[model samples]
Target: MGLWFLNRPRPIKRTISVILDFLAIPFSLWLAFSLRLGEFYIPPNQQLWIFVLAPVLAIPIFIKSGLYRAIIRYIGMDAIWTIARAVFLYSLIFSVIVLTFNDLAGLVPRTVYAIQAIILMLFVGGSRMIARWLIVKSDHHLWKEVNAVRYIPPVLIYGAGRAGTQAAALMKLSNQMRPVAFIDDNVTLWRQQINGMTVYGVDQLAKLIERFKVRDILLAMPSAGRRRRSEILKLLEHYPVHVRTLPDLMDIAEGRLEVSDIQEVDIADLLGREPVAPINNLLSKNITDKAVMVTGAGGSIGSELCRQIIHLSPSCLVLYEASEINLYQIERELASLALDIPVYSMLGTVLNQQRVEMVCRRFGVNTIYHAAAYKHVPIVERNTNEGIRNNVFGTLHCAQAAIDAEVETFVLISTDKAVRPTNTMGATKRFAELVLQAFAESKTLYNKTRFTMVRFGNVLGSSGSVVPLFRDQIAKGGPVTVTDPEIIRYFMTIPEAAALVIQAGAMGKGGDVFVLDMGEPVKIVDLARRMIHLSGFTIRDNDNPNGDIEIDYTGLRPGEKLYEELLIGDNVSATEHEKIMRAEECVIEWPALVKIIRELELANKHDDCQKARAILLDTIDGFIPQCELSDWLGNDN
Candidate 1:
């Protein structure tokens, strides 16, 4: 019941409002006549017929003034103006009808229209105000029906800006989550009341949290860049309150803002690096008025790149995806962006060199962003053949096709896992990187297309990321599992990773492996502790017996690492930008790498697991056996 009125049913409301509109007309007429005359006189017997026809005749004028369509529940000053117009028209017609009889001709003049209009407005418009009050009363009743909003843990909003105010109003409307107070850093708004709620100072956060029993603090500074937002989040992190943030403003699709727009706070907020706002002209320089093709455009990073690129005013955007559902979803989303840019989706895999080449030739694709890859480390470790086929062979196919088509630029989204790999997944990714490096060098000599790879660490909220897994485990009442107490990983937000990739694509010359500086690594155990505490629970261990939830150490899984590195070798040099660096590393020539690739491909065809493993070992140096080679061939668990 509480949630019901908070988010109402639209169709039922519209029908109810239309009925109230017709009834308010006669009600206002009686109130007007009785008020102006200073007495409650009954209508004359002959005049009853005139009042009946008055409603019928006035219906069109009222509709023309748009009064009939004015919703009582959402009414404001606009509805009042529409009511006034409808009233003047109705009263004028009624008076003119009486004057035709000549009996009351001299009694009422043209001024009666103005008088009746004012009276009708009072009763009809006043009734709407009454209706609004009733609806609000009912809404409030349902909201506090079970006192759910109050029980939802008191929350404080950080900003009082337009977006913050919008978030606050939405919170008021959503009875499930109540914002106890507003906390603005701005001195001008301190202590002032907005929509009847007192605005508190940011300095008063501690006092307010204690007094109000605040259990959550929503960071409403969506427009704040990463640096400012990180500072604000760090200040709030000290208190044991779950923190959430409004997503970046550019991503906010317009409508009356909804509650879903608010996102659970991410660890990337700690990264402290502000995203370089993409210069639209620079982003559009090459893609605008040109045809673009994105291979694996339905995968995590790939799909996002497609979504962002479509806005660059491309003449045509082609999505080449191996997955059916992902392709459909991306296509639908692109259509909704509504830029009127043509989108062509083809069902094809990057491993099929012929298919990839045919599509590039047919579409005349100018730019290609190769994003499809086998990314999950442990999963890829188990399916070694598939990983090598998809990541290495697949990339070879796309790069060849891009070269064949003479595409201007080709960017591959690489990962930190590719740096000095110990597992099959990492080795494949590294091999793929080497393939691009070799291709770029050969291309420079042969004078062909440009190729680049953008390498970065784990992006928050990707399909296989730890954040979502932790959130899900936390959502369920119980022990949150951490792989190891000392395990640490670098994190980057999805958008930030995507943004850097785009910027990297533009800055590089060719075959340059660009590495983004993912700020200081965070311990998995520490992250789990913060999550538990912020979720309004105490971590249980030998230290605190009365704790609510326990954090357990689940021994590391296959191909798991205690720590990860971003650079493979120390020969990395600073690029034009501060965060990006170009790593100079060893690369295998096409002839040498091709032999190993062919042997591996043949081994996979025969399901000869040993030969495949042997080929991988010979191909990538420093390939130490981290988890016993027996596990790779048989069920050794």
Candidate 2:
């Protein structure tokens, strides 16, 4: 019956509420009179009309107060308050009428009105509360019956604050997970009940986990700082529970995401370093109101650069990408952003000197962020000639075009591997940097464009980054591969890297090599372990033979490095932005660098990987091949 009423239409439910209230109002009055007289006293002729008048007056008042409009399944405090106010008004008017007409109404008891009002208030309010419980309970039972085979894992929510309470409420409605309790750092909240779930301290996590068999812990502290979150994650890492988190408070607030929309623990939370707020002046210096062009605009870094640039309100944004699909996706996204600024998406490779120059000239491009290049180390090592042609001559063509178009600023996105360069990709990137440096030096007389290179370590979530690969491996319940136990690399988030790159570019004078201060490098084995553990899995090693996931130590790939460096030498100076620094590195003059680039291009045309390797080794400083040339085409000279 309760389920039938719960599924009824709103009008039918409201009508039922009205009929129930009409019946309860007069019965409450009769009970009040009997209790006041201390007997089962029947009302006299005069007072019989008083009982009939009781409901007539109250019913209209209740209707006006919207009492029947409240849904029994979801009635809250406001609805209860409305009932209270309506009953009080009715009681006041009934008392005034009875006392004023007592002589004519045959002497009604003064205590009767007060007694009946209290009874009526309880009857009206309590029935709705009972109905709400019944409907909700019936609905839950029905849902459970329908999904009897589906297992809903119980979870513990961290942080017994507003977000946690809300998360618990949302979980109650979810079929996938059930929230069992809250774990908070606040000692005062310990053993206290929130939304019927007890809040416990971190020490009780073991008992709670064992008692409830919780396999996941949802982090509900959206407002907590990264350091605090990292500390919490470190504490949780000891337990066998998968950790997920709400997005940052800003993302939740602005994006309309709920606290219960849990996601995998952010990779940045492991870094624990709070990003320094970007300097607005430096961010907008080369971008604001300028015609900016981003080569490889559909790539990870290039696309992020575009996203940030649109907010700064550029006059127009030019996306020059080699891939048709990438260009289409980014263009569609920018169009959705709905900024008044014009966005021009051109499908063209940076390798075409004339095409790049024409785009720059037509767009009156003031700033060019050159980000197009092959970056995967092993792939570039195998495709040696193509890698050189793209990373080396691609940069050359863009730089030359920037100069020809008289573009104001040009920034090349370089990598940490470019420092010592054991891989073909890294060497080509270094060679590209040298090309820009030479151009910047030669243009000292004309000074048409300022060339800057921003070098940083690996960016999390970028294409070919290990973070996603490890996540996929962990999800697949298998061996997570690491190149070497001792291998370590610096890591930064893509957005932060892009913002710092922009700031660094603004600080560039000419021929500047800016090295971003990537935080301490993390060991590959430790990273793999942390990822596995945080994902609620244990590493399968000699000590833990029954562990969930195995760690496979695949020896280093061709041209892979055990460690990466950001600066070529220790001669580095701090820039205006704290995270960005200027490096004093060797630069080949334009005359010498151009000759080497032409030889590389000729070798590339003939598919001579050996000659190309020789040119790169002879040209780039500290260039060493980690493995013999493994070009798909034979490396015969």
Candidate 3:
């Protein structure tokens, strides 16, 4: 019956609290007088009226204090403190009324009022606390009944700062995760209780994991330095908990924090290098107030370029992509940014010269960022005919159209694999570069269009990047694959790559090959090991045979080099930007390049794989085919 009453409507609960305060106020005053007289004495007429009217003053005080606004189940110490203040004020007012009446002055001692104040505070505050405890206990049991199939994931917060505390409070009220404790590097916070959970030092992480069976760890250190954050990630790598983190401080300034804001560790955080701020002048040089168009605008690098382009206040931006879905997605996203500039989404392939010419003419394109290409090495190697047709011929068509339209600047997004290539994708890209270089060499063509190419290494989170592959493999609790133990590759974030591309394009001459300074190359095997460790899992190797994940080396894929090179030759000079460089390499004349394009067109038309391979081998310098003609023949059949 008592449980049912506690669970009644809001009005009933408020009425019950008001009535209790009314009854407790008079009883406390009566007790004070009886104790002062040392007997169970009835109050005199003047004092009786004081006692009876005391509740009237106290009830109004309680209501005005907002004491009943807080729900009992969630009431905390702050709410209890408010009750204390309200009772003290009520007692003081009642005492003033008694003293002013003069007839009730001698009826009760001044000390009785003080005693009544203390007793009233206890009754009022204690009753609320008791109700809160009972409701919380009942709700917890009911929560368990509603969720019988799966237990909530237990979590540990890494930082004990304000962000960490806020995240903990949010997690506690969520059904997806339950915060178990806090792990702080600060010694002063060690072993202290925060919001009911004990804070432990970094050294006690393993012990806490065992005690609580923790499954996930949240990194709430939004302002931690990169080196310190990396150190913490390294320290937690060998444990068995999946790691997640909150966004930086900028996200918090936008709005309130929520449990859903926690995200998986970004690949950039693992790189441990602060990104360089883009130069405002260089970023806005060619883009501001210019008519710009990006082919392959739906691609990883192209899409990023479009996003950054819209912010530069371009007069108009055009997206020319072959894929229907990719073009639609980028179009929708740019439209939502609600920029004042016009965004034209055109459905056309770069391989069609007429279509490229028409779009260039229609838009009066001031600058063209040609990013469309068949970039996947293995896939391109299997389909060599289509790869050459798209990468080589598509670039030729775009260049011709730009020259005809008198587009001021044309930038080609090249790859590190284009240097001394071994595969079809790399050779085709190098051929595309040669095509532009040939155009730059011709005096008449150079006067019409300025063509430049920016070459860089692998971009993390790109379509075929290994970072997402490793993350997916780790999540499945199995063996992660690497091409070769000794293989290495340079990596950069997608945004950084796009920024460098824009800056490089702005600094280009008629036929310059701009190369980005891709930081040190990382070993693939070491990267796999580090990824497993940072996710709180040990490598399954010979030393620790009972590890969580195993690293497997599948032999290198076809046409995949152990390492990639950005510059074709030793003749390289630094540009104005620290990250961009000018590579003074070889180039073919327009006549020679045109002849090679004609041969490629004929070879593709006849479905002659051998002839096409021979053309690439003879045209591109230092070109070597890793697969036999029969290997491609099998794919063709």
Best by lDDT: 2
lDDT of 1 by residue, 313-425 (tens): 78899999999999999999888877888999999999998888898889888878888888887777777778778998899889888887778888888888777677877
Residue 587's C-alpha lDDT in candidate 1?
80
Off by over 4 Å in 3: 1-150, 635-637
Candidate 3 local lDDT, 135-238, one digit each (tens): 76665565576558678878999998889988887776676788889999899999899988889998899999999999789998989876677778878787
Q: Estimate each model's TM-score.
A: 0.76, 0.85, 0.80
Q: Root-mean-square deviation of each candidate, in angstroms?
A: 5.9, 4.6, 5.7
> What's the distance in Å from true for residue 397, model 1?
2.7
* Prediction 2 global C-alpha lDDT: 0.89
CA lDDT of each prediction against the hidden true structure: 0.76, 0.89, 0.88
Model 1 accuracy (lDDT, Cα): 0.76
> Which candidate leads in TM-score?
2
Query: C-alpha displacement of 205 in model 1, angstroms?
Result: 4.6
Which regions of candidate 2 fall more than 4 Å away from where they truly are? 10-128, 143-149, 250-260, 444-446, 630-637
